[model samples]
Target chain A: MIYELLEKHKADFFVMYASSKDPNFYYAVSMKLPDPAFYAIGEDGTEILVVHEMERRRAERESRVKEIVSLSDVGFYEKVKELGVEKALAETYAEILKEHRARKILVPKEFPSFLYKQLSEHFEIEIVSNPFSKLRSVKKSWEIKEIKKASEIALNALKFFLEIVKKERRVEELRRKVELFVYEKGALAEDTIITSGKRSADPHFVGEGIIEKHVIFDIFPKIRDSGYYSDFTRTVIIEKDEEIAEMLKACVEAKNEAIKIIKEGVEAKEIHDKVCDVLESYGYKTIRQKAKEGFIHSTGHGVGLEVHEEPKIFNSEEKLKSGMVFTVEPGLYYEKVGGVRVEDLILVKKNGCEVLTKFSDYVEVIP
Target chain B: MIYELLEKHKADFFVMYASSKDPNFYYAVSMKLPDPAFYAIGEDGTEILVVHEMERRRAERESRVKEIVSLSDVGFYEKVKELGVEKALAETYAEILKEHRARKILVPKEFPSFLYKQLSEHFEIEIVSNPFSKLRSVKKSWEIKEIKKASEIALNALKFFLEIVKKERRVEELRRKVELFVYEKGALAEDTIITSGKRSADPHFVGEGIIEKHVIFDIFPKIRDSGYYSDFTRTVIIEKDEEIAEMLKACVEAKNEAIKIIKEGVEAKEIHDKVCDVLESYGYKTIRQKAKEGFIHSTGHGVGLEVHEEPKIFNSEEKLKSGMVFTVEPGLYYEKVGGVRVEDLILVKKNGCEVLTKFSDYVEVIP
Candidate 1:
């Protein structure tokens, strides 16, 4: 894979300067580093890692790369004395690459600007797309297991949400309760949107106050420190008002239509188009045709190390492949009727998709 | 302040392309943003906030910026149809600058590289240091209140740590219990380190198993969603071991020695030098002299929106000022004796420093 990326980019080596916060860098090195480190893959697929002396021991123990080098190995302190911290750091990076005899290095588009400004003087650098994103879009077996675990935690949170909606009538308190419950289950529910009534129509509003009609509970909880995320949304209709009954029906139809066509070799955008067609067929407007109301947002996005990642299921022309996972949700939002959405996580397979979500799409709530 | 920064940089306009995750951006806007937005200040001190149509309403309501504009207002749809989304976005940003007749623009060093690549075609951009970090280094009265509140919460967590260590009697479980207690107080304790015995010599190890003679508890909890953080470290002695008693004394002496010199008009590096001097006087080597065994870290650092920020208390010459908040921590580690650290939150005033930490340095556990 590393050789293929180097060949595709026409690079002598792929140099990634990033921290653990960067999902691509984390995916590449298979470890989380709080500080910046250099990870390089040579044309011959020889992987090298460069780190500070302080992190050298941990890198040797935990990093997947076999040939881990420390800055001290390259005379960092002497260089710091000669050139100062900023210049010495940049010079040391250059020295590492020079020792490898790398000429044309490829860096991700998201490379640190400061490094680019400093390193561009020594070598010809090509700013290319992050090779890891496409690679990470298709999940590994272990990664899928983690996602499935997160999904289970999320489904439990959904059940907890339903249970708490009655006792904890206030939306703010109910949100806190659901988040605490998720944390106790070894997952973190950050920014879990629990919105209701007219405010729910805004889509991103984290609402407050007593429960109202057409409440949207969108929960995307990540398993603690694993980077795998679970996303699920369900609009609970309390007291089944006639105003939003048709909107719910249309959303469910659109969601089902999108899911029906997902399989290996199918274009991802076709799913979004089908959702749009289904929603438009119900006499509702869509943003695809430049209309502001109705289905205003994109159909879905790939969910992985980052919450919204590659193979975006909107206007993408990328073919669906096995091991790709994403969300398929369709919603109808109106200021008066509020917002109604039904979402589920789907894993692409050979013939069809395995719906990772276990929760049912039941709408009516007695409370 | 804006005018002073503009004059200092000699730039026609100040532009910040950032998301809420950037503390500098959050400081400038006085609000949190989930997505990237454009913030510009003209020479006339006109603050313009540019956001997507979906966020325009919220920005107008919540953002401190007076002139809030939506992308749609700048004909984003028409440009997207003609030039595509990426180019249109860049063009619109340039369009705003052209409208202000901006000749030179100053952006923070951490500006998005991809945006820089696209926008450089239109304007001459100067990558200056983040002006907001210097401004944030000197805390406001309200900001000091938030930090003080976070400090109180951290001190309470320290007491809870004592309670849990006796009941739990295990390193890993105690770490989790302390973190959970902090979370219950509406703060997040992430990557907390509670280590014992020789393993504590590693300094950053999060250890497991029953407690040993010398155990280090370093708790840094952040107030949830507020972006304020509190850092406190205490090394507890089980049954008053004679091995690490001298080490603890040296650490406390070094910490107090650093704090003694902290006040307005003092160079931050002098405090670090004083700390190193105290430790060396006790015959302990420091990192400044290239020694790895004893004092191997910086004396302290500024604390505010980011846990570590400007006015670095290291080998630097930045002068201290009134209203600046920071930490005074000194630590010593040896393989046989284990590690000991004493850290406290501090606020610099005109004449002296305020010890924001209320917890005692008493190390005896009696367990």
Candidate 2:
């Protein structure tokens, strides 16, 4: 598929750095390597990996590439003796591209400017948007299964959190428990937002102190082995008020309305508009309506290798395609009443979307 | 400090995307944000943060910057309507720079080429090596304390692993146990290399399968609250052989040699050379001597916010300075006897270096 994409782009080779920081690198190599190394795929479908001597054997074993070359094997030391380490590395990469007879090399858009300047001096380098991003956005069936598995683990963590969220329970303690549960299951739970009362008004708040009124338990865990992620957000009501109840209902309805329109050919913006309309109809203001409160964030976002990937399901003009996995999270925030959000991982299918997250939405937890 | 650096460079402003992936971003803002947003520091020491409407409140509360500008306030929607999201973002950034009467912008060396090209069209954009990297390398007393805390957690995790590395125990299972222990303590243990037998011969191998005669357990965990990290590697022998025993002794000696020379004004390369000479004198081949096996990697690297930061101690000409913390790891690898490595985090003081990792080197785990 990458070869086809390369051919379509009229490029001789697609080059990227195998740094775990870049999801495109992992998507291309199919495995993570600690050290940043040169990875290039030739038009002839040759997957070449150039790594340091220390990481050579490991890269050979883990990377999906056919040819693995060590830096020492390619006169890297001799080059370093002449030039500095940084220049030597860039030159070595350029030499590798030259050896491949690659005149027109396609690099990721996020390629370092310094490296780009160095490589451009040698080759006809074009900064292309991550070619594999779109490909990775539309996950395979096994990828969907991996995501579902992660979602299940996250749901279980959420359930555990809900069971323990007493009136006097500290948000930090609840977060720690959730993280421990997920970690024990060989997953990583990070940036968990367990805000209560007025603190929950800020969407990105990683809450602390005693639990009160509504508690937003947003658990996003990444499965350790697969590097796949699952995001599940549920606002649990400990002592619900009339306004908070209405807000919760409106947020849930908005999320459902957006999910209902998700299919192979639906425009992402249309679904976003639907969510906004639903929220606004319930006397809630949205970012689209130029209001500071209510649903301020996007309706959803594509989730895959990275927690956030391409094909954003916000005010995007892109059309949803089959096999695309995204999160449908409609949240309502008020300065006085706190925040209520219900998020679920969804897999867009031919007919509709499959809600991978099985956890109950906004639950009233008895304190 | 960033403003001072910017002024020193004769740059009107310094700009970066506030993405957690870029340590410099977090270093400048003193906060972590999920989404990538615009951040700029002017010559007058004014720190400006432009974030999404949803993240406005959170950014205001968390970010150290006094001036927090929401994207919506900057006519982001109007700009997006005229130009695409990407172009609009760049345009808005350009507008911000123009508003500040700035014509020159200094960006990090790792800045995106695509963004550089966009910004360059409007202003003088120079890709500068992270000016803050040098500052970050020289840690404060509090930073040293944080790293020490991380080291203690990693040491605990390592001890837990040594206890569980009995015969018939899978390396993956033992690794999981170590990770779970660290995660429970609010630290992240990632890329843990627990290789046994021939697999250990590869330094970077994250091992699998049953425990053997020799196991290399390299635990590098970062503190959850403080982004500081501690890296420690110790090769344990379950049923020790003469070859493995000798290798362990040589590695320990090499590490000690490197640490002995670490002090203010000491050359990094001299320390590296000491490690190489010690390992070579023990009849082990070093990378410096152009050998495939034995002491293949650098003696050590500076450890801080990122595991591997500035002031590289491997064939580097830079001199060590006080308050700089680094790792002094030396390993010997052979196809026949697998691998043996001993590493310790050290803090360079005015007089000498203090070893931060407290775990014993080369433990013998009985089945």
Candidate 3:
């Protein structure tokens, strides 16, 4: 995939530091290293990893790449002892690029400004908007399997959370139980939202206080072994009110409506529009009608390496293909009545979409 | 602090997206928002946050700043509808800067290159290596309190881990137990290293396999509410071998030696050299002597909002000041005998240093 990308751009090298939080670095190297080490794919599709002396052995052992060079090989520590870390890194990287005969370097759009300034002084640096993003949007069989495992772990954690929510009073306690459950299963459940009542109206609010009538439980866990993630949201009702029940019903319906339109070669915007149309028909205002209220956010987004990646199922013109995996979430929020969101992972199939999250969205914990 | 920085640099504005992972964005706003929204500090010290319409209410509620504007207020959504997200964001940001009359912008050195290109076309851009790093380095009273709390939580978690390690047979199981214990206490223990035997030789290796003669356990947990981190490392011996015991003693001694010299106005490099001198005297090669083996990494680093922050206590010339909290870690590794590391958080005082981690470094688990 990277070879095709480099060839198409006619670039001499696609250089990136594994240190940068850009997912492309991991995508190219297919390994996770602690420190940000240098990684590049040469014009002839030769992959190289330049790491510190301490990381050399591990890089050689763990990374899929064939050639792993130590920083000392490029005189990094000696240069650092003389010129300091920043200048030494810049010089060492420049030397390595020169060794590869790299004249045109294609870097991620989020490339570090300091490094860009240093590299641009020696090479024609082109800012590419994550050359691997398109490839990452379409999940491979292994990637799908990882996501499935992550989703299963999240569902189990959710089940544990629901069990606790029935007994636990505080939102913080419930959140802790969910997080610990996920961690025990070798996954991370960070930013798990367990908001109640009016606070649930805010999409990004990681909730607090006592568990109330309308509770939002959004669990997104990253699988430890594979760096893939699964996001699932379900607004549970404890002591349900009619208004809250109506909102929850509409949210689930809208989410299903969006999922129904998922297939190969489907326009992302069409799915979003389907969600908005369903919610609006149910007498809910959307971001399309008003800027600040009702169904405010996008229907969903592609989820893989990052929680939110490319091929956003918003008002996008991009068409979805068969291998693409994303989320089909539709939500409605009322400032007075709180919010209800139903989200599930969707894998685009040749004819239809597979809802990867097996747990039912309409969870009502009647305590 | 941001106002002072902008005035000192004589920059019209310091613009950044909340989306950027730079901690300065959160430091500037004093709020945590999920999405990357527009944020700027004007020449007149007017702190402004331009967020998505949905996030506007919460931003207003949560952020410490006075002025919080929605994207719609700047006609961002309409522009996005007309143009697209990328072009519209550029135009919206350009207009926002123009409204502030910002002709000169000082961005963080790690600023996104793609954004730099867009902003540079309109303004005089200067890349500043973390404008707030120096300020963040000096821990405030509240910040110190937060760090203290995080360290306490980590100590408790470490105690829990030690109890489990005494019982558990596998490194993976012990790591999972430690991680779950920390998460249950409202802190994240990601990448908690628990490597055994030769695998412990690699500092960054998050270890695996069964209980062995020597094991390295490095736990760094971020406090959930405060976002402060505490790092602690302790190499334990399952069955005490003479070589492993000697190495552990030397590591603990080296760590204490570095900590003993930590006071206000002490050069960071002197502390690093002290660790090196102690370790070298114990017949171990340092990074200064050889790039790869023995004590290869830096002695320690600053612990605050980020795990590894400024005031790196290494071959650094920067002097430590009162109220600066950091780590004093010294370790020695051999390919054949595995590694031994002893780390503890230190708070620089007017007279000396306060070791924040209360747990004893010496541990011998008999199976």
Candidate 4:
């Protein structure tokens, strides 16, 4: 698969180096904390791998690569130091590419600028933003199972949050309580969005103080064991406002319409615009200041190991794929009236998409 | 302070760039989103900054630097398209440097390699791996406060864990419940090492199962609000063994002795060896496979914001300093028999060190 990506981009090799702590490194290697390593894929299917000394024994035991060069045995840094930083990096990359005898290399946009420069010195190089991201946007069966497991846990916590809702409970306190329940289910509940009342206008509002009438709880937590991530959102109204109700109804319709149109072979942007149209028709101007006020951000984004991945459901020209997992979140935000958002996870199938999270809309709050 | 560090390194200018999502970027600039931004510090204390077009507004609003240029706004890619990638990048960097009147630049090791190459082409560039790591090693007043807050919450949770001890209650179940309680306190019960009996052979053995022997409960949680971290350990012997009790006493004494010698201007490695000497005097060797299996890893490590920081209290040549917070955990692990580790947080002061976490050393598990 990596060879095909390199060929598609007309590159001789793709070189990536990352520390054990980085999530990007985890994505490339598929095994967390395997080693401080570098991976390279040649256009003709030649793959070269290098790992740190302490990690070599374990890497040999568990890694997916066919060829492994242990840095401890090879004296990698000595070679680099002797060759000079640029020449050594370039030469090392070239040695990997030479197996296939290719002349060009492709790298992710976020690849270390100096390494890219070194490669460019010896071989033609191209910067491809998120070359691997598109591959990861879609989910496999096992991936969806893990995501569902995480979602089920999150929903249970959400239900728990609803049951324990109190007028005096602050947004911060509520978020902490919900996170505790979620993490106990064996997920790292990290990025939590608890926006209340007018604060919800920020969309990513990290709420504080006593929560008012409208509260938006957006949670995207990674399941620790599997490293699969799940995202969910639901807005509850404490003091009923007619405007809030009507706006929420529009967002629901928009989300439903987007889901209906989302499937393999569909354009991502079309679904995004369709949601926007639904909001606009409901008297919420979107797009620009002259447009609607309901939805400011995109309809949704692809979610997988990372909460937000590639094949963005935005103005992006990328096409949807069968294995892709994304969210259909439609929201309405008014400065004074507050915001209302409803989100659900979707896994694109051959014909359509499956909703992963099972939760009711219009969940009435007690008092 | 940053200017002084740059001057000390003889860097005419300093460039710090990290994606907004990176915590290191947050250390330099207080932005949370992904922004392709650069901060240039000049010899004359002048600053030149560049940011992504989309993030310009937010960067300007939040960052300490205000003189910002938009990477996309200046048509940077167009330059690469015209002048060729290397020359374009070098020329662009040169222009930025000239504007700041910089002939040499210091960059963090984590900066993208391509940027490093570009800067290197125009002027001398040094891989100054975030000088702030050292600055951050020493806890500031505010940072210490955060650590204290996190410690208090963790200690409280440890007390809860001790109170809930029942021989019948599964250790794993107790671990989960205690983590939930810790999170409810608005802190991350990130990891709790609950090891019992033979499992204690592994220094980091997180205990499992319902057993009628020694169980070690090590609580290390990060205070979310303050971003400060704390660590504490208490070993409970459900069924006491004379050997285990003796080893525990020696380990506790070693920890205390190490703490007493730990003050400003002392080498960390010296302290580590001193602790090793104390353990060896009791027939316990630092090597794991010896007759009396004892301390396998280093005595402890610097603990603050990230749990593990610089001036590692191991076989390190780094000197201890005032405001440096570290852990003094010494243990004697006996294979299949049991193990005892007493850990406490220590803050190096001018004369001696202050023991921060006030927890009982001897823990007895009542059946």
Candidate 5:
């Protein structure tokens, strides 16, 4: 990736550009790029890629790269007839990095601080911290097989939203039919939350229009041509009263006791202090007593190519390694039994983690 | 719009923030905030908003902010137990702009330059150029009724991709059934292009798989609860020989002679030089002679809540202002009948434009 940050910083190139505001330029040019093209890599590994001759034949059939040049292959319209399409796109990106003779570059920390203020006036930059979001927070083996095919299409769009929530009752048409059943199983939903009651205690409510009595689906998607992401959350409880059935059995036993203390080296704040010590030994109140109600947020995160990334189980100390991939999700809000999450998607391993949202944890909806 | 940039930069609080990399923070607190909350406006206009105590009960029911507050109202867990969670979120966003006593804060140019280098160590920031995307480049009458309800659902998903391209010849299953018919007609599609032949001369090709004899269909989207946006390109020429039927009648008379001189004050480079004077009086070659291919890109832009924004009908001098709204598409590429754009969606009026993508341009379907 960016030739291992241009041969680990003895930089002679690495560049990259907005690829629609850096998803580390599509994890370094896998390309679905919507303009602002550039790219680079070099330090002997050479890759190149530029763009904008009306996106040179779609970045030579969607990038693989080893020189895919353009800006009318240098002299971009003779520097846009003397420096104008905004200094002829930074002098044709400095004539395509002085035809690969580029010297000292690198970049990443979400580059484009206005094209790093116009190529830091011609060269020697640096930046860093976007090693494809710490190598997309671990996962490999085909990025965990495209996040296990986006967690099996977000567990078949949350079991097709419990069979269209007993013939649907709104919440934005059951989150547009679980985002068209995760775009007919090929993946690409976004903010797909069904949210209900007290707007499912607002964990970023995406709800609207009816469908109450405790809902919260939170599907999360991505796979469309391997952008790889997946997060799943459950909570349906249509008739489990006993105070949201013991707040969804303490959110499925605080997400199976913080996924039985994760794996490889643990301590993502000890699985968010073991889901805040089993939702504070079932008496609730969390954020370790900063308490904004009950078990307020955090008990999960780190999913691939950004469905929220990096270790973050919360109050982190980092550690947990072995091919990461996250989401433990032990929730339990309550403007009186509203949000009772349970999420899954695991993996970690080298001694413990795997789940990948096999589903079913607090869905009681048989009405 | 940030209270008219806090009474035209008299600035004393114009704030705003990341709401998913600022769509002008959902045009300033109309809210769908996916973190990086804070918002402001004041200088007597007072709006506030804040966030992150697990998003203060979903920004108090999706913001119309008079004040929503919450990094635990103020102390933020005693500044995250004394400046820890990344300097306790910049000391609880400086105690939520020192409870609105801010001092010259403005912002915008997509703010988050690492939270303006840590809120520029306390206020007096200023940035500008994002007055809700230049007041979302003019379209407001409920943002032109949510871009005419996303231009009547991208002209019924480009006439349902000409009846599913007479039996879906793949190209990702006709862009997943035209993004599940623009999500069962309520809007929220993305990069929906069906591209065909010679990858439709690469106007950012989104093509792949079977479909041939030319196709483009670029139906853009948006509406889901008025996040506005709507663009619609049509290029289906399945069988229209005679030099691709005279390059689709010179890209439909260069988008009808650039919408017969759009109204208000004209000059968006005179509708991209009258669609390059009817595609160089039909001999094509554009980028106004920078060529590289016939009629390459831009004869349209500006579209509400970003489907590309700001009066950019190409070589810009910016005018055409009557509550703007744009896209007049006029393309004409060639690899022997490869790209023939003809989009619509106009608006501009004062004595002229309207056509919010009424359909039927160069579609020619009967193979």
Candidate 6:
């Protein structure tokens, strides 16, 4: 599919290089770190993987590509010593393109210019739009399953926080206990947004102080082996107030309105506008002098290998896909009055979509 | 002080530029988003900060740089667009350097090459090896206070997990609770490493599963409004065993021994070797084969803006500094036996150093 996209995009052939710590490298080969693995994906549907000695074992273990060439076996580095590190990286990449006889190669915009410049020395390299992000924007069935598993782990941890510790634990202490619970459940919590009181007003407010009654527990976690994430947000009221309940209701309405409009082929930007409208209707103003103060950030974004992936679901013109998974989180904020946000992960299917998070909207625990 | 370094190095000027999302930009300008700021230190010891219009107010609120130039107020982006983003960036920077007109322009080596290429188009650009990491390596009195506050949050969170939460909460739940704790303490838990059992063997393991007996709880948090971070690691024995105890002992001993030799001007590699020797003496073999296996990864690294910063204290000839704050974390791993790591934030003082963490080492629940 990627090869077809490359061909359709008028790329004669593309050279894919993996560095020591690039996640894109991990995505292609499933090997975390490769000692300068190079792949040439030709328009003719031919794919070749060139790996340095250090990554051979893992490449052989998990690589989807069939053809594997070892650089050390061929002394690829020694051939480029005369060029130096900067030139060598470029020249080595060029060699792969020349070997494949690709005239015009499509490369990611974020490709390091030094290497890009070097590759252009041999091939007519164009900084092509990244198609990988779009491909990954949509989730697969297995991916959705993994997300569900991750969400289950997150929701369980929230349940534990409510049922177990009855007294007010230090904010940090609560975070640690929740993390341990989730970690034990075969997933690592991504950003555990446990903000409280005045701090909760900041959309990204990571709270401080002895976590008092009004606390917002927004947990997003990824399953280790699966590399799938689950996002959920629940406002736990240790101490209750009318404002808190109203804010919580506003948040839920905004989020639900957005979630309801999300489906295959739907405009992502329109969904964001709908959420904003819901918040504005509730007499809230956005922080950046916008309509809704609570919804300062985008409504939600696609979630996958990276918690925030591509095909932004916020104020973006990108259209939703059948397999795309995103969050429908809406928040309401008032500085001294505290804040409330309710979020759930959703997967766009053939028809409407499936909400992966099964937890209740309000899990009230009176501490 | 930074300007003095540029003068000493015979560079006419030095500038630090970062985009909106780049954290280093935040470090230099001390202002958050909307502030496209740059800290330009001239040979004459004149420090100038250029920020965008939207960020003018925040820049004044946060930064210490003497001159704050709001680009938008002076038609900076329009001028930049006219000058070309590259040429504009270069010419704007060159104008600052020309004020001194001494000789050379210095930039941090890690500065994006696009920026470098742009600046180099108009100025004699030289890669200025930044000592920011080293400068920030050692914690100051106030910095230590922040880290200690962060550590307290982490330790309290861990203790709460051990004492109150009996059943396995989902990993995400525990992480959220810990995060909330840190926020309440006026800080953000940068990343809390919560991995369990077999997952624990992988040092960077995160996410998924029921609460297992052997869980690795690594928490690093940054104090509110301050970028400084504190890191701590504690392995829990929900089900205790002699092997686990033995592993913990070896790891603690290795970490302590590594800290013993830590002084100003000591080789980073030597410290790593000493720790490795201690672990080996305890019948644990370092996995030299795979970088991810056994006692792989560096012994310690400088910590500040980012969790893992610079001046890696492993196989590095980089000399230590008095104010450098780094981690002296050592771990022992076995394929089936899981892993044990004891980490503490250390302030490299002039004489020896001070351990920032005051958490108990023993794996016992806090009553």
**Candidate 2 per-residue lDDT over residues A1-367, each given as its tens digit:** 6677778778899888748667888877766776687888888877898888987877777878879999999999999989977789889988888887888888886788778878888888777777789889899988888888889898899778767765338777777778888888868888798888987989888898888877888887888888888888888888859888898898888888788888999998998899899988988888787788888888778787788787787787788999999888889888877888999889989999899997666587775
In model 4 chain A, the worst 10-residue window by lDDT is A287-296
Best-first order by DockQ: 2, 3, 1, 4, 5, 6
Pairs clashing within candidate 2 = none
Query: How high is the lDDT of residue B259 in model 1?
Result: 84
Assign candidate 6 its CAPRI class. incorrect
Q: Write the per-residue lDDT of candidate 4 for residues B251-310, one digit (tens) a residue.
A: 888888888898999999888888888888887877322222567666787776566666
State the lDDT of candidate 3 residue by residue for B1-367, as single tens digits. Answer: 6677777888888877646355777777787776687787787868888888778778889898789988888888888878767668878888888887888888887677877877888899887767678788899999988888888878887678778877677877777777777777777777788888877888888888897887787888888778889998887777878988888888889888888888998999999999999988989889878647789888888999888887788887898999998988888878888888999999999999999997777977777
Residue A326 in candidate 1 has what lDDT?
92
Candidate 6, residues A1-367, lDDT tens digits: the string is 6677676777777666655344565566655442345766788877777764434544565578777765545545566457655566566556656667777888764455456655666776665545667777777778777888888888788888786547646777677678767765667663477888776765554455677667888888778656677778888887778888887888888878887877888888888888888878877764223432455666787788767676666655677889888888878766567678888888887668888886777767774
> How far off is residue B252 in model 4, in Å?
4.0
TM-score versus the correct structure, for each prediction: 0.94, 0.96, 0.94, 0.78, 0.34, 0.64
Query: Cα lDDT of all candidates, in order?
Result: 0.81, 0.84, 0.83, 0.73, 0.76, 0.68
Sort the candidates on lDDT, descending order.
2, 3, 1, 5, 4, 6
**For all the predictions, what are the DockQ values?**
0.48, 0.80, 0.67, 0.22, 0.17, 0.09
| Best by the TM-score measure | 2
TM-score of 3: 0.94
For model 1, residues B241-355, the per-residue Cα lDDT tens digits are 7768888888888888788888899998898999899999989999788776788777887888888787688877789999998888888877677788889989999998998
Backbone clash total for model 2 is 0
RMSD of 4: 5.8
Which pairs clash inside model 5? A70-A73, B345-B357
The residue-by-residue lDDT of candidate 5 on A235-319, one tens digit each, is 8877556777788898788888788778999788888888888878878889777888887777888888778778778886878
- Higher-scoring candidate on TM-score, 3 or 4: 3
Best by lDDT: 2
Highest DockQ, which number?
2
TM-score of 2: 0.96
Which structure is stronger by lDDT: 4 or 6? 4
> What is the per-residue lDDT of model 3 for residues A37-122, given as tens digits with 9 covering 90 to 100?
78888878777888878777777777788899988777787787788776788888888888878888888877778788778888
